[model samples]
Target: MSWNPAQYLRFADARLRPALDLLARIGGDTQPRRIVDLGCGTGNVTRLLLERWPAAAIVGVDSDAAMLACAGSTPSAIGWQLADIASWRAGFSPDLLFSNAALHWLPDHDRLLPELVGQLSPDGILAVQMPANFAEPAHRILRQLAGESPWRDALGAVRMGSILPPADYEQLLRPLCHRLDLWETTYWQVLSGADPIIEWMKGTTLVPFLQRLDDSAAGHFLAAYRERLAAVHPAGPDGTTLFPFKRLFFVARR
Candidate 1:
């Protein structure tokens, strides 16, 4: 699916907090010579990687050409590559493999996660963060709406891949790494504007479903989705909506 960099960066601060949190926990003593930011959209988090490790050679890999263009447009030493994160391989072993809010879209993490860990250089670190809020109303409603008439044929098969549970991830990665850290955090994001949740999903969760429909059908689907979301997440007297988003983070050292 095509990505809108502007839409995705609309909630930049909120989207970035987890990434910053993950970066802080990545062992301050680390002095990696090479780093890879997998699924680095628009190089937002990739920039952070550079800031933390100025001497490290950093490459940001993403499948979307548009996003890579936006990232590259910004003058920096960081190299931007257009490649699928799921099948991406480093020409040389990277000291750090960092991915923020990516990798959930790929299937078969059982094999994928271990392979990623193996790709890291000896004593390398693999730090990742992924959204684990699939059961939330935002996604549940999207799935529910897509199954109804007019949209079923177009979207019935549309699937939003999700991450494994905390226990499952521990079981999958502990054996591959000498050190592993896994945790979850629920960010009760305070958002403003009418139908903020819908706006939020438009950047990520809504992209696939919206892409499957024509403009007219997509409009209707969005309208229905907006109505349902408002009922569940009404704006408070302060005119801000609270969206509790849960995310999973892991830091593994090989």
Candidate 2:
């Protein structure tokens, strides 16, 4: 199953806020002839790029058909393809490689980033944003809780990848590109209702956990998760839950 965009309302149009910030810093008059979104999940990022560069030919690629289906609904002008970046090829060298909340799934971006840059035109740009809250209490406690569950035997080996250390990312991409911008920020998301936290995660971190189990185990997982979350994520003074989320933003122009 692909990620359901409806489940990730927190990252819906709200994604544009951060996406614009990243793009603005990497601003230029070099209009791209082509653009590609590496893991175009549901095309929110893809659509944003299109809105910014309507003249550019844009393509969104993902490994999941379900995700591509949702992306296809945006417009016939945007090309959505089902393919893995590891082996995927760009029909034409893109002037900009844009990715959001994607790329941590990639194992060796340090080595891979240069290769992707090589796919760019003489002077292309690469902009990416990824959630980097693996160290946060929310993800930490959830993983620990899952490890203790009976179903851990099957899912225990799954380890989420890091979105590169801030320095490591700069070190890897700075030399290859003419300009590089890298930083991280925490968005204090005020979610209404005691249960919105679960809804927020279903579109992301909770996905793998739930996919590991059958219907029964998945229900148990969510129930246990909610119980743990309810204890840690106490309601704020406004009677809403505040999930302080963090993400890393990086842009390198070659």
Candidate 3:
């Protein structure tokens, strides 16, 4: 799916909170010599890594050229690589492998997570955070709309792949990790707009559905989705919408 950096950043502060939370939990004794930010969209979170470990050599890896282009230049010390996160390998075993809001795009964490763990140094750290808000109305509305008429035919298998429960992640990583910190947080974000929920999903969840439809059909889908969302997540007295977004976070040190 194509990503629009501008659209994704519409709620930048809200989207960035989980990344900051994930970074805060990654602790170790030795200073990292090398770090990699997998699926570093627009280098926003990657820039935080540079700030935290200015001495370390950091690389930002992403698949989209447009998003990478928006990332622009970094210091000579930081490397920007264009590659798929699923198959991308670091030239050196990194001291820290960080991915924020990226891994969920790929399915099958059962196999994928272990492959990433193997790429780490013996004592390396793997830090990740991803949206676990699939059950929320914003996403539920999309699934409901996708099941209807033209959308159903055009957007086959529109639902997200299975995202394992929180306990499942702990079970999967416990054997491989010496130290593991896993938790979930629900952020009550207050957004202001005509249809804030729809605006928010347009950046991420709505992209795939929109991609399959032409302009007219896409508009119809959005209208139907908006009506459904407004009923579920109506604006408050102050004209702000409270969007409860849940996210999963984990940090494993091998």
Best by lDDT: 1
Q: Each model's C-alpha lDDT? A: 0.92, 0.79, 0.87
The per-residue C-alpha lDDT of model 1 at residue 185 equals 98
lDDT of 2 by residue, 1-254 (tens): 35666676565655556667776766767688799989887777778778778888999999878777877875558888889887777867889998777777778886778888888887888888888889987788777877785967856866565677899988898889888888998888777854788877787777777777899988887788888887888887878888888889988888
Residue 116, candidate 2: how far off, in angstroms?
Answer: 1.2
lDDT of 1 by residue, 156-243 (tens): 9997869889999999998999999999999999999877998999989888988988899888999999888888888999999999
Say which candidate scores most in TM-score: 1
Location of the lowest summed lDDT over 10 successive residues in candidate 2: 8-17
lDDT of 3: 0.87
TM-score of each: 0.98, 0.92, 0.96
Q: What is the C-alpha RMSD of each candidate to the true structure, in Å?
A: 0.8, 1.8, 1.4
Please give the range of 10 consecutive residues that has the lowest summed lDDT in model 1: 82-91
As a whole number from 0 to 100, the lDDT of residue 192 in candidate 3 is: 91
